[model samples]
Target: MNLAERLRRALDAPAPEDLLAGDLIEGASVTDGIVPAAVLVAITRRAEPGVLLTVRREHLRTHAGQVAFPGGRIDPEDQHAAAAALREAEEEIGLPASAVTLWGSADPYRTVTGYEVTPVLGAVDPDLPLSPHEAEVADWFEAPLAFLLDPANQRAIEAEFRGRMRTYYQIDWEGRRIWGATAAMLVNLSRRLNAWS
Candidate 1:
């Protein structure tokens, strides 16, 4: 089976009991009126697949200058999580929705920032051209899936936040540091895929 098919099957299966990043954040679930959001985990179809990621513009109000998947809050007009993800991808990276074939969605994640995010898994044409949105994205790049899935590449970093120590996972690619919600989602994906391997 193809990568997309394999992932779809795993993602569609029952949720596993693996610990999530949000669980580590103190009072992460105490937020009221959480908002709905979605992100596209767009993987390229190549001999060695890579995942597309973007760096947010430094001036953004939330998660500024952070590396993330192409996605945002679901709009009222969006049909569902997948539709929202596709729209966000096109708006952020100029990647046409036609260039992607969505498999399925992984488990929804609740962020400490009060956004419930659904990760839409999809495979895109490896050669599709991408033009980052200057207003939202600082730049865009791809990381090899094999490297991302390896547990050895995952690092734990901690610092005092709001007078309490908090830990998070990160994966260093070249000079890019992928951490926070982005890294957490990738960890979840890795667990799902690895369970089926």
Candidate 2:
């Protein structure tokens, strides 16, 4: 089967188990105040498929300088998760909503930062004109989809957060670090794709 067919089957499959930041939280509850967010997980249609990612601007109040998918809070005007994801992707990375051919959305994942993020998976032409919004995105790059889907690339790392040890998954592509909710979502996607394969 082709890449699009594979992704379509995976997305059409049963909802996967939720992977939450709560797994890393040591003591206190982590799901008190939840905000709705969505991300565009765009797979570049190229000789070797690649996943689009962005390095958030350092000056941003939240998740500054972190590697993230093009996404943000679901606005009141947005109709659904995929709509919000597409809007955010356009606003942040100059990726036109028309350029994305969405396969489907995955099971939502919660982040330690209090956002319940729905990951919208799609495919886009790699040659599409893309320019990062200077204020929101420091830079953008594409990581190979094969590299990201490999279970061996996922690593669990622990760190002290708010005086408690927290564990999270991280995947390093070259020197770019993908972790937190983004990494968790990718892990979930990997499982779905692997199962369908």
Pick the lDDT winner: 2
Off by over 4 Å in 2: 16-24
Native-referenced Cα lDDT, model 2:
0.87
What tens-digit string does per-residue lDDT give for candidate 1 at 32-87? 87789999999988878899999999999889999999999999999999999999
Residue range 141-162, candidate 2, lDDT tens digits: 9999889878899998999887
Q: Would you list the C-alpha lDDT of every candidate in the order shown?
A: 0.86, 0.87
Predict model 1's lDDT versus the native.
Answer: 0.86
lDDT for residue 57 in candidate 1, whole number 0-100: 98
Q: Report clash pairs, candidate 2.
A: none
The alpha-carbon deviation from the true structure for residue 165 of candidate 2, after best TM-score superposition, in angstroms, is 1.5
